[model samples]
Target: MLKLVVCVKAVPDPEKADRIKIDPVTKNLIRQDIPMVLNPIDKFALEAALVLKEEKGAHITVISMGPPDAASIVKECMALGADKGILLSDRAFGGADAFATAFTLASGIKKLEEFDVVFCGMASSDGATEWVGPQIANFLDTPVVTMVKAIEENEDLTWTVRADFDNGYRRVKVQLPCVFTVTRDLNTPRTLSFSGIIKARKKQVDILGLEQLGVDPEKVGAKGSPTIVSDMEITSNTRETTMIQGTLEEKADAVLELLKDFGSIG
Candidate 1:
């Protein structure tokens, strides 16, 4: 049977307006009181894995790296039809930038040693760096095709993938055992079905700490991160605003005047 590994991340739902809250000291994401949800783009990655599973009888495994609470995410993946799910959690793994996260994920993937294909989201909602998947592929010495919108396996086990580029799609063919970061256009991710949700409780999610996976402390966290987020600040709409209560034509004229003042239009 074909074996596939899909990497997913839990992110604070950012769909809410002005919902981002950062930690004062660390300048990092404040998770203490936030409701975390799976990264939006990861739904596409999971759906792609599920499609491949249905078409080829593949064994899909979902893996993530985060805190112990991440166990809940693994069960959610199981509910989505993944055969296995794992959480790579440990204190030493905290504060991991995308590089460190990729390194640790590479270690965990190395341990699995069985996936015929690997999938990842285009990027995390919080970080948006879009670096981990290709970096992990570099570490694993596997070819990576990213921003994939559609994928199919050929008779020779080569994956034909289409990626959105400048104004069109780019077609790529990669041999099996490669990696890809899927785009949101892949498929619509179904929520938990009754039977799947019931079966999820019975499905066992394998949780592994850093030590359990032999992840080197010097190569898997802050110590291994090469780049630091020196600073981040919330965007402020501090510009002055004037209320213009008027009809559609008046509003359009007012908007045109404002644009002229800003040198956007003359």
Candidate 2:
């Protein structure tokens, strides 16, 4: 049997994007009342793991790092078919940038039994930096393939996959114990079912904190992060509407003149 790990995130609801705000002092998202949901693209990554479990009888462990509420998303993954869920939650783990976040997650992963494969979304909707997956692989000292669209073969210790490239896609054969940051093209995610929810209720979600992982607190949050937002400003967009008065031909000429004045046309 294979052991697989899928990394998931609880991001602020994208539908409520307008309500999102940034903290001027911390340079972090102010998510006081915002509802959090599983990162959309991460569903594809979890789906990939679920498919592998169904085909080859593997155990899938879904892991994430966030506040205590993030366990809700972890349970959602269990309802969707993951075998186990783990959430790394602690106030010390707050305000983590991509590098710090990945480091913390990698430390948590090291506590698990040796895993054969690690899957993650190509990027998170909130940050969209597309760096965590690769950085996790770097910390794990494993080969990484990003933007994976399909898994052509997953037999024995070698697997073949198709990944997005510069303009097209490339096929790659990778060894086991590798990391794959998947794209939505990989597979369609399954929805929750009543039976799955019941099963999830029986399964426990292990919550680990910075001390549990035995990682340096200074290396797992804002203080450990190398990148800092020195300044941020919100720019307002205002549009001016002008009414054209005259015959149809005159209106057309007027619009053309306005376009030229705005540099929208030559």
Candidate 3:
């Protein structure tokens, strides 16, 4: 049977972050009391995996990298039909950007390298950068296709996919053991059935620390990270203030005059 590994993330609820207070010296988000939930996009990723499993007799596994609380999200994935869960947790794994996180995840996935496909959401809600899937693909030397909306055919080692891209959609074929980042429109996430919920409670999750993975601390987390947030500020400049309200003729005339004076319609 083919193994499908779905990568999921536990993200902070945007509203939970509304109560954050930054430290003057550290400038890190005060996440002590902030509540988090499983990221919505990853739900689509898991759903796609489940649909494939139900149709093709595949074994599905879910993995995540975060603190201990992240295990909760993995359990949720199990409740949705994932056969196994793995949590990549360690203090050394903290403060990872998309690249570092992907590297660590790729390393962890390598430990269980029997999977035939890797699945993930296009991006995390917290950091909408959407760089991890490609980064992991680079680390694993596997082909990657992002923002996929449909999976037409998946062979033991090949995939024909339709990705929603700029201007329109694009069709691409990729080899297997590859990474895929999905958009929400890919499928409607099925509700957790009662049987799935019970099975989830009985599923075994393999938790691996940095040491168990046999990797150096300096090579896994913040120390291994290549990117960091230097500055984050909200700017207020883009707005539409010149509202013109009138009939069609008057509005057209006004627009023409304004464009001519502004050197646009001369």
Candidate 4:
């Protein structure tokens, strides 16, 4: 059976984006007041793994790193079809940048003993740095394809995929034991079912702290992170409208000039 690992994250529900806040001191999101759901794109990654499992019997493991509350999303992934769930939670892991987070996740994956494929979202809805997946691949010393929109399994050792680029997409043939950061274009994620939830009741979400993963505490959390946020500000969205009075052709020319003045277009 193929062994697959999908990384998931709990993010503030986008529906409540207006209510989200940032901690001025910690330079991290203030999530306590906001509802948390699986990172939007991460569901696509899980769905991709589930589709593979349905076609060929496979063991699917979902891993997440966040506060204790993140276990909720881990359970949700199990209810969606994962065989096992692992949560890496510790106070020390707070405020981690992409590099530290990937290093910690890579360490946890190493503890899994064996894995043929690893999946991650192209980026988190909140962070949107799009660096974690590639960084994880670097730490694991494995091949990685980002923005993967389509995948086809070949022999046990090889797989084919289409990854998005600037102008078009690239068809790639990669070996097993590779990492893929999938995009939402990959697949439609299924909704959670009651029966799946019941099955999850019998399944457990194992929580692993820094020590449990046998990682250097200094290297796996905020302390190990090299980047620091100096400041952050909420952007104002107030808009001003102007009326133009002229002939149709004149108005069109005026709009083009305005766009050029604002650098909105060349």
Candidate 5:
């Protein structure tokens, strides 16, 4: 059976986006009191794995790194048809940038010992850098295909996939033990069901920390992160309504003039 790993993230609820705030000192979003949900695009990645599990008889393990509450998302993945779940939670993992986050995830993935393919979302909803997946591939020394929209062929050790390019799509053939960062266009995710939830109750979610991962303290979180957020601010957008008076010709001219003033037209 093929062994698969799906990486998921617990991001702040998009519905409560207005309530999210950034810390002045840390520059990281203050997640306290805010509800967290699985990253949106990650559902597609998990769906891809689930489809494979159904079609080719594979084992899927879903993993994540976040606070204790993140375990909920991992469990959710199991309810969606994953065989096992793992959560890497620790204080040392806080304030991790894309590179640091990828490093930490790669460390956890390495501990898994064996995997045929690692799937991830193209980007996180909160941090849309689109770097963690490729970075994880780099850390694992595996070839990575990003923005994967479809898996054209999946057989044995070799696979063909269609990925998004600048204007069109490109078909890529990669070997097993590779990483794929999938897009929402890949597949439609299945919803949670009662039977699946009951089955997930029997499956265990193993929570690991820095010690469990055996990663350096200075190399897993903010300390090891190279990128720094120097400044961040929220800007408010306000709109004003202007009424143009006169005939149709006059109104047309006025609109054109306004567009020219705003540099919307030459």
Candidate 6:
């Protein structure tokens, strides 16, 4: 069976985006009261893994790094057809930037001992740096393909895939034990089923912290993060409305003239 590992992230629900706040002291997002859900793009990663499981004999292990409550998202992955789940949770791992987060995730994958394939979303909804997958591959010294849109071939130890680029895509052939950051174009994710949720009850979710990962204390969290946020503020969206009082032809001409002035029309 193919040993597949999928990395997932828990993000604040997009619908409740208005409730998101920033911590003035830490300069980090304050999500204490907001409901958390799976990062939107990660669902595509999970769906890709699930497709492989159906076509090939595969055992899926989903891993995530977040707070204690983050385990709920991992559990949801289990219910979504992953064989097992792993959570990397610790107060020390808080306020991690992209580099630190990738380092921590790579450490967790290294502890897994064996894996044939690893998948991650192109970016996280909250961070959206699109660096974690490639960085994890760098840490593991493995080949990586980012923005994968489709898996064209998956036979034996090698696979061929299509990856998105500027305006088009290119076919890439990579061997197993490689990392892929998938895009939403890959597949449609399946919704959670009650039966699947019941099956997840038996699957175990292993929690690992800094101690379990065995990485240097100063190199795994905010301390290890070199990037700093200088400032953060909520943007206020306001619209300027103008009333046009005229006959139909005059109003139409005015709209066309405005569009031309704004460069909205050629």
Q: Pick the candidate with the highest TM-score.
A: 5
Which candidate comes out best when scored by lDDT?
5
Q: Rate the local accuracy (lDDT) of all candidates.
A: 0.86, 0.93, 0.86, 0.92, 0.94, 0.92
Tens-digit lDDT string for candidate 1 (1-266): 88889999988777752666777776677776667788888988998889878876788889999988878877898998999998999889888999999999988888885778889999998888999999989988899998998875445678788987878999999987889998888889888899999999999878888779886788877788888877876688898878877999999999899889989986
What tens digits encode model 3's per-residue C-alpha lDDT throughout 184-216? 879999877888788888887788999887877
lDDT of 3: 0.86
TM-scores, in order shown? 0.88, 0.91, 0.88, 0.91, 0.94, 0.91
Q: Which ten residues in a row have the lowest lDDT in candidate 5?
A: 230-239
Q: What digit string (tens of lDDT, one per residue) describes model 6 on residues 60-135?
A: 9999999999999999999999998999999899989999999999999999869988899999878788999999
lDDT of 4 at 250: 94
Supply candidate 6's per-residue lDDT for 49.
90
lDDT of 2 by residue, 1-266 (tens): 99999999999999999999998888789998999999999999999999999899999999999999999999999999998999999999888899999999899889988999999999998988899999999999999999999999987799999999998999999998999999989999999999999888988889999789998888988877998877888898998778899999999999999999989999
Candidate 5 — which residues are off by over 4 angstroms? 236-241, 256-266
Query: Model 3 — TM-score against the truth?
Result: 0.88
Name the lDDT value of residue 14 in candidate 4.
Answer: 94
The TM-score of predicted model 4 comes to 0.91
